[model samples]
Target: MTTPTAPLILFDDDHYMYVFEDQASAEAGWEMPDEFTVGFDAPARPLSMTGEPLDVRLALAGEVPEEAELRRLVADHCRGHLRGQVPPQATALADFVAALPREGR
Candidate 1:
């Protein structure tokens, strides 16, 4: 089978997050088995100059119906995914964005 593309990385002053190609492959979707668990020995290092720990999270979108809808979908999915994983109180917001296009970077 062909390998999947690397996921996108988006960082805020406070955290580092990742976005999958589609919602089904993301944590918000049902595709992952219930037994799944992240295995990182240490928390992700922050890309910010401050050198803080990154609070990584995921986002999903099956297929946005419109351009405006894509933003809402990403926001909603990210919010839910970050809830208990990050802090008791958290909201979705973009800070620094980076992604690899289909063409070679």
Candidate 2:
């Protein structure tokens, strides 16, 4: 049986990451650097599109960072990658991050 999967954002040596279809895909495609044994992987936490709050484990740099931190990281990624409004996937991710409710609100 195939394991159920969801969207994921994977980080490499660089500060940026891409939204992968799932964890398996990310693992399969990832080209790891020999210096670092493991890379960071976080659930995309795509709550805005579904309109349902999800309980997902947030992982980054071997530590669990807060959702706000994840949002900031994603925002930075989008800002750096966005051209004259081209990459629709990045645009979509930016929208998702924008839609997330502020923590403790």
> Whose TM-score is greatest here?
2
In candidate 1, the residue pairs with backbone N, CA or C atoms under 3 Å apart (3 or more residues apart, or in different chains) clash, namely none
lDDT of 2 by residue, 6-48 (tens): 4555444455555555554544454443212223233333211
Measured against the true structure, the TM-scores of the candidates, in listed sequence, are: 0.22, 0.46
The segments of candidate 1 whose C-alpha lies over 4 angstroms from its true place after superposition are 1-65, 84-105
| Colliding pairs, model 2 | none
Backbone clashes for every candidate come to 0, 0
- Which sections of candidate 2 miss by over 4 Å? 1-5, 33-65, 84-105
Residue 35 lDDT in model 1? 26
* Residues 23-85, model 1: lDDT tens digits: 223334223232222211011111111111332333222222232332333344356655533
lDDT of each: 0.28, 0.41
What lDDT is reached at residue 54 by model 1?
A: 38
